[model samples]
Target chain A: MEIAQIATIASKEFWDRIRNRWVLAVALVFTAFALVIAYFGAAQQGAVGFRSIDLTIASLVSLVIYLIPLIALVLGFDAIVGERERGSLDLLLSMPITRLELLLGKYFGLAAALAFSTIAGFGLVAIVLSAKLDLNALYHYFGFMLSSVLLGCAFLSLAVMLSVFAADRTRASGLAIATWFFFVLVFDLLLLGALVVTGGQWGGEIFPYLLLANPADVFRILNIFSLDDVRTLYGLATVFPRALADPWLLGLVMLAWIVVPLGIASWRFRK
Target chain B: MASSLPPNDAGAPLIVAQGVRKHYGNIRAVDGVDLDIRSGELFGLIGHNGAGKSTLFKMMLGLTPTTAGDIRIDGALVTGRDFRAVRRTVGYLPENVVLYDNLTGLETLWFFARLKGVSPAEAGPTLERVGLAHAAKRRVREYSKGMRQRLGFAQALLGKPRILFLDEPTTGLDPEAIRSFYATLRQLRSEGVTTVITSHILAEIQERVDRIAIMAAGKVQARGTVQDLREQVDLPLWFSVRVSKEDFEAVRAALSHLQVEAIEAHDDHVKVRCRREAKMAVIEALARLDGRVRDLTVREPSLEDVFFGFSD
Candidate 1:
């Protein structure tokens, strides 16, 4: 509840990452990936040069969905457990700060670092594409960057939650990887199997709602749905209902993803 | 601000614990422990490993919740919520704290100062106090173990706490550093800072603390001043008597009634051990041996012996 304590812890956590070059490394990864996807996005189609912002965003959407979550998970999976292993938790806890403040401060600080790197990384692509692409494409790319930060925060929350529940670093990281696999790879496959076995009868009505359950899918639908051709190309326009594709609603869902896991993390951390 | 006294000896003790217990599942880490630490007293807690020393220290700082009982610091109860305020007025130096090696010594102290809600500007002077002022700009990773310990001590000295808790503080310190460490602790005590330090190195803290508590198997086996403990344990005293070569037999024979064991019968000295109560009698016996004894010395049992005696 004490903002000063939270800010102190948060600032320390943020600077620690900055000193370790994690922020710069992640930013470089984003910039390199975005630049390549922007300049040579259609290399498979034998096309080169800055492409349409929509095309760049569509490609970047898939990239962010996989990359941001992984980055966030790795960045945060050891937030609490790492402190404990390093034998600093006792000193930290002995301070005049509450566990909630520590947990929130760590989350927000790392979230800021992740958000900063994401913006710096993708903002470069935005600037380069700004001259070539139109205002609408520019908006979509900015939206892509925002959603990417949200997804990172969500995954970071999950990572911190794992750090709290896990007994050690090894188990925390294992649970983090398992979480990534479930959301990115296994969740959709299982949903598709449920659809096939049900002959599109039992769970078909609830399929779109279920897609909203995963922050990655919510991020995907939010970005691609802004464009007609890309939405059709991605084929999510048919699966995710138009009403549920409201950017505002999906943003709320992503916000929930960020808060709910972090809330649980704080709860478990205090326990 | 808490430096002033209450005008009389009616002020509350610095720390009060009543039947404080910590149970991890079926394991009783601290069981029914009652303690009182007075203001400006430098107390020592010595126990074997896993003797619940660290656990009790943690409970005092409100780092861990007690399974039962209560602990009060400066008359304020320490709990999950209330301990936050009390923590600001206290300092702690844990055993083997691995700080952020990436930050300089000054920066590390500032970070901890900020946590304790004190001014980071105090970091420089605090480092100087711990003899790390010249190395302020050096990163902690480049410092030696002794330097790191000084940094930890510097952090604990922040805010000029009324009470300081140190757990096994001299683990890696050299003799000179240990001496200086106690000197600093004595200086703090002069300022009315009650320090509670735990160490397995009994010799290091024997003469430094005001009182000592010997813990064994989650309980305080004995608690008193070193002299008081020596009086409590019925340990035998050592006596070395110097006698001439011609009178060694007479001196030994005279002291044989006291059941003194002849450790060595040198021409100049005869060593024996006896209980403290028999000291005067044995000296009298030696005196009656025709002035054969040239010199006599009596050595009382040390704190180490008393510690082991009570621990066993």
Candidate 2:
């Protein structure tokens, strides 16, 4: 539990990613997508120019749900297994640091990298949208950005867990992709199919809880439920109650999403 | 476990293993083994591949859990959280450690120094110690295999650890570099740093280590000084005599009077094998030829012979 050792590992991971152009590449992608969506999100509705921050956030929420999780998974899928394969794991584990410290250091380092790109990418668009929107709109957009970082951390945690549990790099990468596919695409469909088959009979009471199971869905509900127009568009008022949609509770869930998988990884790595 | 440790004039045993074993499913990597490495001793572990040298080394470092017995370092059992504190005072250079190639050699050393809680200022001197100071600023990717091994050695020398474990440290080193490597190891030993090194190349470490352990099939076949093992095996000595073309037959006839195990005759020289006790007698018989014998050489059994004798 030495902070110095953890900081050393974290700083190294941070520099390693920067040197590999991962941070720059991801930031550029986010900026490009956010700019295009912020400027042209209303074109589908026969409108153009910088739309309201609400519509911009709605567009970016879906974008972040798909993009951030994928980026995060790709970023961390090889964190542990790759090091083991590279023959560096023995050197690192032989150091004076604990396994927990190594796991946390790597997670924080990668989380910082993902958060940096998320902020840098979305912050640029926020500045552009600042002149067109008021303070309230800016606050909502920042919340969206914060949630995007959380979603990234959550997925990064899962990726690190997979890296620890998988036997090799190829298996780790495969598990990372499968995790992304399951959470981002298959989760919602499975939830909806379950609802339709049961006709809200068997698992109706646990439906909202099940939606919270997927961090991506949690990110979706957090951003989409905040705005009135977006809320009506997503239409989760019936199954998802108002109490469960509280921003604080949803944020806690996202934080748990980040911590639990990382905690499990630390446990498994120590074993 | 306490009683199993041997008395050490160098202070106390720095590393102790009591019947340590490791099992990977049905396969046994390290069978029951007992060992003691004293402080300031340069110990060598020689074994063929799959002989469990690496497994035993890992068990000592607590990198892998021992299946049945226990290992102690500095009198404290290396298990659970206690070993974490012990690790700070230990250094290890595993075989084929691929460092972060993107980092400059100095950056790599600094990172490990920080992890070990040493000052980054120590990186320069450590690199210089391993003769990598000139290339400290170069990226590791640009370095050769030998250079990377030196970097790994430099990292292990950080903080001047009390005990060092080097698994196949000289695998990729050139002859000159290997000489310098042993020189550094001797310097460390002079400073009272106990070193445990494993190498399959018995010749490389025969004279370098204070004591040697030969392992086979996941067990230590023999462990002691090279002289002690040689004496135990008591293999016959070899003698080669060079004589004039006319005197070669006379020398062979003189040697046939003694109990020669085997003999070979060339155009101008004769090679003979005799038991250990017969060495002096054989030399005396050759001395009777005196001026007729142009040259004489005695070949005692080497550590390699002892290693093979026990390993078989």
Candidate 3:
């Protein structure tokens, strides 16, 4: 009911985690990666040693696509139920804020923290790549990185939703990890199993919708979203389905990842 | 603190719990209990373990769902969809008061104060009020039990809440802290804050609260002023009358005249628990018998006695 109240709650939650030790630890790790990426780029500057730009691109893809969601998971899995276990749920509930506000506050707070970390990480990467990489390429890299961070936020929102539904923090953490595991490692395997069972009858048609459901696919699409040539990466000499590889569809998928789980969490939190 | 008008003058009761019930499977935590907490008063709810005190308090805070019945605060329903509005005016302090162990006391206070919409300057005075200003810079992990209680109390008092639900607020507090805590509570009462305090320590709350409610077996068996509950105890003014060796027979014979045969004879003394009407008769009969009464100690009915008496 109170937007200011929700924002206040979010500000507290955000700053608490922002000042946490883990954020500095993440920064240290990001700094180390920047250093390594810098050296790798400088060594391959003149002659084609290994394509530092491509390595930078790969780093952007894996670091944002895979690592950030895991980071988000570690941050978000215990958001709600942990407060309940600590007996501070009573404290939060005493305020004039509604359950929707509380959940949204927590969800937004975590997303904001993850987004801030990503921005910092991107800034540090840019500082390292300034000597070799051009400004235009750096802009695209930042955009893809931002999308990955947003996807990570989507996962965090889903985790927060799971945390609310769970009876306790431990169960909530387990469910969050299981969801991340499904999206990251198990979804494709399960889909392949389904395709094998159906004998490729609906794989092409159903795969797009299913991939849209998977945030990792969206992250991967965002990584190559700003590329000048997307069709070349298909590796298929004769057949490249343009629909599955559409950048606009990737944006739609990224938007879905951000909005759908958050909507569900808000609804579940309504008193 | 809610108002400066008058004590118990508000037509709108601070808390009106009518047939407020909650059940977990077959165990009814709060079973059909009606409670009215007046304005500007410290209301004590004393009950033993599993007596549903916590359940009732939780229902008032909207922490746990009520199975049936409704609680009204200034005529707003404390159940169903409108509970959020009810929660606005209420502050709660749980028994365990577990805060973020990683943050400094000042940071924690500022965070909760910010969440409660009180300014940072407002937080400083609150911490000082609870006597936790010195330990504000220390992390919660380093805080002693009493200090954490202080912080918890300060948080609950923020924004000048009209209603406060304190669940065992002084469970492990030291004697000095308890004394100081009660002083703060009295100050809050003067400020017209309506408080519902739950505790197992009955004696500490007797003079602290304006009214008392004794709960047993998920039901409130007695609810009224200290004297009101004492009357429900239905026990007499008991006394242990001691006499000299030479006057033992005279005292025993004197008690017999007042129909005090149910005495626990201990050497030269007799302990008698009888109706209040028989007290004066026994005393006068002792005087007539010329018994040398060395000492007499009278036992009065407190909330504990009232609860256990009616609990039977």
- Top candidate by lDDT: 2
Clashing pairs in 3: none
lDDT of 1 at A122: 93
Q: Which CAPRI tier for candidate 1?
A: high
lDDT of 3 by residue, A144-226 (tens): 66776777777887788787778898888788788878888898788878878988785756675676678886676556544
Give the whole-model CA lDDT for all candidates, comma-separated: 0.87, 0.89, 0.75
Q: Candidate 1 overall Cα lDDT vs. reference?
A: 0.87
* Model 1 stretches astray by more than 4 angstroms: B1-12, B242-249, B259-270, B290-295
Clash pairs, candidate 2, are: none
| Complex DockQ per candidate | 0.85, 0.81, 0.56
Instruction: Give the C-alpha miss distance for residue B248 in model 2, angstroms.
Output: 5.8
B1-312 in candidate 1: lDDT tens per residue?
Answer: 233424214234778999999999999999889999887889999898888999999999988888899999877787745676688778899999678899999999888888887888989999999999999999999999999998988889898788899988887889899889989999888877889999878887888999999898899988989999998998988888887778777876787778564456765787788878888898788788766677889888988899889888
Summarize candidate 3's per-residue lDDT along B154-219 as a digit string, tens digits.
Answer: 888877777789999997799999999999889888877888998888888888888888888889
